[model samples]
Target: MPVTLAIAGLLFATGSNSARTDVDGGRQEELSGLVSQENRKVDAYDQQVERMQREVDRASRARARNDKVAARAQERSDELGRTVGLGPATGTGVRVTLDDAPRTEIGEGNIPPDYLVVHQQDVQAVVNAMWAGGATAVQVMDQRLISTSAVRCVGNTLLLNGRVYSPPFAVTAVGPTDRIAGSLEREPGIRVYKQYVKTYGLGYEVERLTEVTVPGYRGTLDLQFAESGR
Candidate 1:
C-alpha cells in the first residue's frame, strides 16, 4: 500500500522512466525552452505581487482614518498569504532528500532497474506524507507547493509545475520536526520507498533544521480548467 500510494496515477502524465534521461536532443531543447519561459513567467508574477503588496502597505500606513482597521486588514492579508504559500516561511522543520542510487552492482541482485532511480511518486510520497503530518508548507527542489501543483516524471527527472529537476530531490517542511519525521516513518508509501533505500542504496536522508525558509509560490493561481462533477 505504501508503494501503491507512491505510484498513484492521474491525468496529464507522460512516459514512465528508467535510469536514463528522457529529455534528449530536439525534445530536450523544446522542454528547456518551455521551462525557461515558465520560470520567467513565475518571476514576473512574483514581482507583480510584490509590487502590489508594497503599494498596499504604503497606502495602509498613510491612511490614519482607520489605523486599527488597516492594521487588522493587513494582518489578515499576511496570514492568508502565508497559508496559501504566498509568503516566505521560516521555522523549525525537517529536510528529507532523495537521490537515485549509484549505477553499480550493489543490491542489483533481484531488484528491478526501475527501483534503482527515484521517481515522481517517490518524491510525491515524501511530500504528501509531510503535509499529512501537519507541514505548514513544503518545498520540492526549489519550488514551493501550491494547491494546484503537480509532480510528474519524464524519465528519471521530476517535472514540477513547469520545471524539470534532477535529484537528489530535497523536500523540506516547516513544522514540528519530530512530527514530520514520525509522519514519514509511519507513512506506508514512504516506508515502501525506504525498503528500496536499504536494498539499493537509493537516497533517503533526513535532517532536522532549527531554521529553514520556504519561499512563497510564484506561479499563477488561475485555473485553466476543471472537471465537471457529472
Candidate 2:
C-alpha cells in the first residue's frame, strides 16, 4: 500500500511539472509573436520616414536650381543694360535724328502712303551703321538698344525691343566721331535714304555730342524652360 501511494504521488508531481512547462511554452510563444508584430510596425514606420525624407530632399534641390536660374538671368539682364548705356553714364558720343519728310501732296500712282513715313529698316540701317563704326554703346529714343533687341516697323509705327514709338526717332551712340560720320556717309542704304531726304525733305542730322549720357535697358527676364545639361 505504501509503495503504491508513493508511485501515485510521483505520477501526480510529474503531471504538474509537465503542465507548468506547457504553460511557460505557450507564454513564450505569445511573447515572441508580440515582438515580431512590434518589429514589423517599426520597419513600416522607418520606411515611411525614409520616403518622406527623400521627397523633402528632392523639393529642396528643385528650389535651389530655380533660385540659381533666376540669379543668372538677373545678372545677364544687368550686364546687357550696362553695355547699352541704359545704366549710369560716363562717356562721350554722337546723336543722330531721322524723321518723315513733310507731305507735299497726296499724289496718286507714285509711292504707297506708308512709304511717305520712315520705315523701321531705315532706323535699323542707321543703328547698324553705328555698330559697324565701333560703337561701344547705343540708345534709341528712351530705350537702350542691346544685341538682342530688334528694330521693326509696321506701317508708320516703329517697334523697338518689343515696345512701340512714333518717329522723329533719335539714336545716340558712344564712339569716335570721325568713325561714326564716315559710317553714316559710307552706308549704301543711308545714301538711298538721303535721296528721299532731298526729295521729301525728310529730317536727318548727325551731331557730335561732347558728353552724352544714355539710359539703361529696362525689361523683364523670365525663364520657364531650359535644357538639363545647359
Candidate 3:
C-alpha cells in the first residue's frame, strides 16, 4: 500500500511539472511577440516624424525668403547650427582608434580580464582631450558628438546615442592635428591607458587625415523637460 501511494504521488508530480513548463514557455513566446510588435510600431512613428520635419523645414525656408526679419532669424539659426553640430565640419585632423587586447593575449598573465577591455572612461578621456585641443567637431564611429551626447560602455561594447558598437572604436576630430596630438600625449588618463596598452597588447592607433568631414547630427533634438531658473 505504501509503495502504491509513493508511485501515485510521483506520477502526479511529473504531470503537474510538465503542464507548468508548457504554460511558462507559452507566456515567454507571447511576451516576445508583443515586444517585436511594439518595436515595429516605433519604427513607423519615427519615419512619420522625419517626413513631417522635412515639410516644416521647407515651409520655414520659404517664409525666410519673403520676410526680412525671418531671413535674419534664419541666418542666426544657421550660425548656431554650425556651432551646435547641426552642420557638417570639414578640416584636417587626426583619427584615433581604441581596441581591446587580443583574446589570445588574455589569461596568459596574472592580470584581471577587466584590464584587457576598453572602458567608458578611456573613450571619454580621449574625447575630452580632443575638445581641449581645440577641435571644431568630433565624430565617434560615424556619429557626430553634440553637447548632450554621452558615451557609455557595457561589457566590451560602446553605447552612443541609442546605437551600440564594438571595438576597435574610432574617434575622428576636425581640428589642428598638432594641437590635438599634443593634448592627447599630455592627457593623464591617456597616459595610464597607454601603460596598459603596452603591458596587455591592447590596440591603439592614430592616423592623420588630410581632409575629414564630421557630419551633422541627425538625432532628435527635443528636450524632454526644462526648468525655469526664476
- How do the predictions measure up, each by TM-score? 0.70, 0.57, 0.76
What RMSD value applies to candidate 2? 36.4
How far residue 104's Cα lies from its native spot in candidate 1, in Å, is: 2.5
The CA lDDT at 72 in model 3 is 92
How many residue pairs clash in all the candidates, one count each? 2, 3, 0
Lowest summed-lDDT stretch of 10 residues in model 3?
Answer: 1-10
Clashes of 2: 3
Per-residue lDDT of model 1, residues 1-230, tens digit only: 22112222211222322223645455545545555565566556567877886787688767634687777777887688777898888899989999999868435767676888898788889998899888999999888998878777756777665555677889999999989888999988888998998887898899999999999887657774478898
Candidate 3 residue 110 C-alpha distance from true site, Å: 4.0
lDDT of 2 by residue, 1-230 (tens): 23223333433343344435465776545544543454455446546755775696476556656698755765675576565554755467788899876657324337665556687778988998998888877888876776556666654555544344567899998888789878989998889888888876778899998888766554323332355785
Q: What does the lDDT come to for candidate 3?
A: 0.78
Q: lDDT: which candidate is best?
A: 3
Cα RMSD of all models vs. native, in order, equals 6.8, 36.4, 13.2
Indicate the residue-level lDDT of 212 in model 1. 94
- Span of 10 residues, lowest total lDDT, candidate 2: 1-10
Model 3 steric clash total: 0
Residue 152 local lDDT, model 2: 63
Once fitted onto the true fold, the runs of candidate 2 whose alpha carbons sit more than 4 angstroms away are: 1-86, 105-111, 221-230
Model 1 lDDT at residue 184: 92
